[model samples]
Target: MTHITVDLPETVFSALRKTPDEFAQEMRVAAAIKWYELGQISQSKAAEIAGLSRAEFINALFRYQVSPCQYTEAELARELSDAD
Candidate 1:
């Protein structure tokens, strides 16, 4: 994995009350959530990017108010019909 360094104001960390490592982890989770919401990545990929387990990522989706499933109403109905 390529590492990129981000320089932020000391006050930013103080204001957020998080250590640099903690902030970095939060950033990763935020990025993963955004990518998942945008339909740019699968849940597993998002979890990997966030350094979280699949179940953790699903919980994060709920926390972030993002839909876990990508299916539309019509697609969901079609799938349900097929399952029967």
Candidate 2:
């Protein structure tokens, strides 16, 4: 595993009420979710990046208020029509 280091003010942890470890975990998940939302990465790739299982990542989507589906309206319509 590769390790990345970032520097932040000590107050940042207290502001978020998280320990450094917890903050690190949250940062990873936040980045993964944002990237997934932006369509820069697939859900599975985001989950892997966040160190979460696929199911857990889907649940995290709800917590982050991001849609788990990556489909556009047109794609969804096509899929529905194909299913019929």
| TM-scores for the candidates | 0.84, 0.94
Clashes in model 2: which pairs? none
Where model 1 places Cα greater than 4 Å from the true spot, the runs are: none
Q: Please report how far candidate 2 places residue 67 from its true position, in Å.
A: 1.0
Query: Total clashing residue pairs per candidate?
Result: 0, 0
- Compute the lDDT of residue 16 as modeled in candidate 2: 99
Model 2 scores what on Cα lDDT?
A: 0.98
Q: Over 4 Å off in model 2, which ranges?
A: none
**Model number with the top lDDT:** 2
- Prediction 1 global C-alpha lDDT: 0.92
Looking at model 2, residue 40 earns an lDDT score of 100
lDDT of all the models against the reference? 0.92, 0.98
Over 8-71, each residue of candidate 1 has an lDDT whose tens digit, in order, gives 8888777899998999998999999999888899999999999999999999889889989988
